[model samples]
Target: MKPVDSPERTKNRTRSGRRGGESTTRTDILTAARHLFGENGFTKTSMRSIATEAGVDVALVSYHFGSKRGLFTAVMEVPGDPISRVTAAASGPRSDLGRRLITTFTSIWENDDMGVALQAMLRSAVNDDGAAKAFGDFASGEMMPALAKTAGLSQETVRAIGSCVFGLALMRYLIRAESFTSLTVDELVDQFGPKIQAIVDQGR
Candidate 1:
């Protein structure tokens, strides 16, 4: 029999070749889901397809993630409580808000596991409005309110700030689509952090 070199099959084989154990099962599922979501976009990628790619039963995937949306959330896993971090930085006496904000974002996106997770999540957001809405909902419910509290901005201003940060997150870490990707997190902090902080400082 001839081997099939189709993208799905090839990707499935690549995913399956990794060591087996239930401990790694969730990670494996996430890895496969990320690849699919990144390449095919969220709407096109299905839970069953993810299971097939991972060489696991559909039930297993369903068991772990519960639904396609849930799987996407798992696949796009951003490290740490993004809400808490942003709010904490925003709340601190209005001094060096940019530095704190930059440092916090840097810490989350620079780490290997979190970086991949966050990148995967952003890719979904780029390709799926539902995913984008989910991200917005998170910011609106958790991150924005806290930011508003600390920055003394109205909800509209907070939303705008969230939009800017979301754009930065997508462009820099998720797509890595430009010269910006080459810059170290510290360099990014120095360059972009102050600008972000300025926005919060003005609090318009």
Candidate 2:
């Protein structure tokens, strides 16, 4: 007869194998998600693939992230290029900062990956309060600080500009409002630039 492994040894083997500790398993899922999403994009990547890459059960992925949208939102917490892009826009002539910022934002949203990311974020935020807070924190922590430091802007001005950006993003990108869609990017910059400038002036 085959020798039976002790119960303690069997338990140790289970923990040491692909099924890691709880926190370790959570981190593995996120790591797997980032790699797959970056390589395959959101639509092509699935929960099963992510779990497979992480060497965990699909149910564990669900237990941690709740859903694919939730996982995407969680993945977004890993830093992205938006902060760098914002820094570039802000680190420019103070006079036309508004136009630069608007231009930068519009261009970003136009990218396919970013557009999908926005959809995931908006959809996930609908029911999950933590998802909404993550976005708010990213805006306040990364985007706001970059603008405030590079452009000599106050928190209030940055907040107002952020509001305008988010509002336009929601209406133009997410909601697909015809009124917003009717305008070209140049037209958007033309119309919104001065408004942002006025806010920037106030914060000075």
Candidate 3:
């Protein structure tokens, strides 16, 4: 698959200048993008589709947003402090760490706008090498460390626990993977909690 440009790379590349009905046009595009992104996700939703939805020329999307990723960033930005939430999840009794963390992670996606942000981020990472490396760095250097610090475990251990859990968010929400999506949150906790606790217990 061809890589899409990261939002930062194309941030300054937008075509500028006011056109007739520019405000309305931009609003239209944003409205269309929001709908398509919510319904089809970042990867499946195309600039042309957004344009079609907005009844605008495809070039207008590039003119205003720079690229598909740029549009996603502008419109589908994720909200809340995930790192803080992770820290909170890791607090208290460490015995139920797996269940606590899994519940918090799933709540972020299922209950709010964070799901859209994560979906876009995941799709972008899959489609763009730069996005993958950029997010990977944050996951390794930042987010995982918070969980490690709070849980009294090494980053490697937290990552191992995360590796066992985070994928289910993608499978259930993003990929809509069979069987995986069919399971309830409690079912996921029942299945993944033990594996995550196993890693945590190893303390490696």
Give per-model CA RMSD.
Answer: 9.7, 10.1, 13.8
Per-residue alpha-carbon lDDT of candidate 3 for residues 6-41, written as tens digits (9 for 90 to 100): 887676455452234778888899888877766655
**Ranking of candidates on TM-score, top first:** 2, 3, 1
Model 1 / residue 193 / CA error / Å? 2.0
At residue 94, what lDDT does model 2 achieve? 91
TM-scores for every candidate against the unseen true structure? 0.59, 0.66, 0.61
**Whole-model Cα lDDT of every candidate shown, in order:** 0.73, 0.80, 0.75
Question: Which candidate wins on TM-score?
Answer: 2
lDDT of 1 by residue, 1-204 (tens): 977699988778878766557768888888888777666666577788999888888898888877776776665576556656777777666657767777877787778888778877778777887566656555555567777877677787676666766778877876666887888877888887778777766766
Please write out the lDDT profile of model 2 over residues 1-204, one tens digit for every residue.
Answer: 999999999998887776557999999999998777656656567899999999989999999988776786578753245666788999878989988888888877776877677666766555566555555655666568888999998888888999998899888877889999899988999998888988987786
What lDDT, from 0 to 1, does candidate 3 have? 0.75
List candidate 1 segments past 4 Å from native: 1-76
Q: Candidate order by lDDT, highest to lowest?
A: 2, 3, 1
Distance from true location, Cα of 99 in model 1, Å: 1.6
Candidate 1 — what's its lDDT?
0.73
Q: Clashing residue pairs in candidate 1, if any? A: none
